[model samples]
Target: MAENYVLRTQRLLSKLPFSSWLFGKVISRRAPYFGTITPRITQVIPGKCECLIRKRRGVENHIGTVHVIAIANGLEMAMGTMAEASIPRHLRWIPKGMTLDYTAKAGSDIRCVAEVDQSAWQVGDMPVTVTALDDNDTVVVKGSINLWISEKPSK
Candidate 1:
């Protein structure tokens, strides 16, 4: 089986200097919009991914709270990373849509966690759940990312 690109890149960059910067650069190249959130992928495995986004002026709303859109971007990054590592090499996935609910005020840096069930791995629409937590570990955002999964094209 072919190695997952996200996993392979993470392993390779982890051995080099300034690995976090390199990883962010790679992610920005692939998804320009995600660059706006400046997400840091902290963990990625078969069915889960965790990402962090610092609270900064650029991502703040008029009320000095982290903007909803910024949180959504971070959530998406977490879900995308999880999907990349969880999907089989023979399978391909694309985000179809997302539904998010803002549950509280985000007054600090945010951590987003995305997870999928192994049983949910199949050629169809898969709904993954993601939650964003504030510095106090309070849930600030909850969302569901719907991804369309299918077989990879033959070479």
Candidate 2:
């Protein structure tokens, strides 16, 4: 079987209570920048990841709305984690860039989802679709993250 530790950890830890919160802390500790928005990793499966960020003071902007950068951070977290979990055995992936569109005002908590269902692990760029939904299930932000896929070096 493919050795994807990210997916393995998600499968194991997800069975415990408060697993999502715990997983978020673990991820943040590994990549401290993600701690800025305090994203909660709600789900992690092959090709898909779901995350949440509350409308807290630290993430608010001048107009009492969620900051675009904060939501972008949360979206990046979802995409990065999902890529780690879904990467193929002989291949590897890294996010090259992200493009986001602010379609609506982010007035409430945000739910970020990333999906990459197709088998696009060839040596090239693969785009993953990500969307940030408000409490009312409206898409506040939408975007795609471009990942550079390449082969893993031989041990």
Candidate 3:
């Protein structure tokens, strides 16, 4: 029954304009954000994804602005979803490395988007680049996430 439900959900999500909508709905319902840095997955495609987060007092740093780590979380959400959705269900992936660059301050809502060149993707290792932008449409943070993808070894 659970497998059937998963298939149904996947099918429905594929039909929609935004794949992240399903991912966000699922994650939010199962394990909602614990901090003020809540992210909403907006769209997901073969090699790209988008997510958003609203800045709040709870997410402020010492400077009284949106925290850098909070933006990183949003970037991860976007990149991870893109990488995971790229592979087939029979395969699995785990993040291997992440490099982050804080470019600017975030004072309002933020959007994180990620893209992976399909031609550059392989079954072994793939690099997904994610970028977070503030409400003004300026990049605040950038992340390069490495994912290790492979099939479950026979036991």
**What TM-score do all the candidates reach, one by one?**
0.92, 0.94, 0.77
lDDT of 1 at 80: 85
Off by over 4 Å in 3: 1-25, 29-36
Ten contiguous residues minimizing lDDT sum, candidate 2:
1-10
Per TM-score, the best of the predicted structures is: 2
What is candidate 3's lDDT per residue for 3-108, written digit by digit as tens?
3333345567767776645556665554455123566677766678787887787778888778888787777777766665665655678889889888888888
Candidate lDDT values, in order: 0.89, 0.90, 0.73
Better of 2 and 3 by TM-score: 2
Q: Candidate 3, clashing residue pairs?
A: none
Q: Write the per-residue lDDT of candidate 2 for residues 1-155, one digit (tens) a residue.
A: 37478777777888999888889988888889999998899998878999999999999999999999999999999998888888878888888999999999999999999999747667899999999999999999999999999999999
Better of 1 and 3 by lDDT: 1
Stretches of model 2 off by over 4 angstroms after superposition: 1-3
Task: For candidate 2, report its TM-score.
Answer: 0.94
Query: Candidate 1 on 1-155: residue-level lDDT in tens?
Result: 36688889989999988776678668768989989888888787789998888999999999999999999989998898888888887788999999999999999999999999867889999999999999999999998999999999999
Candidate 3, run of 10 with poorest lDDT: 1-10
Q: Clash totals for all models, in order?
A: 0, 0, 0
Which candidate comes out best when scored by lDDT?
A: 2
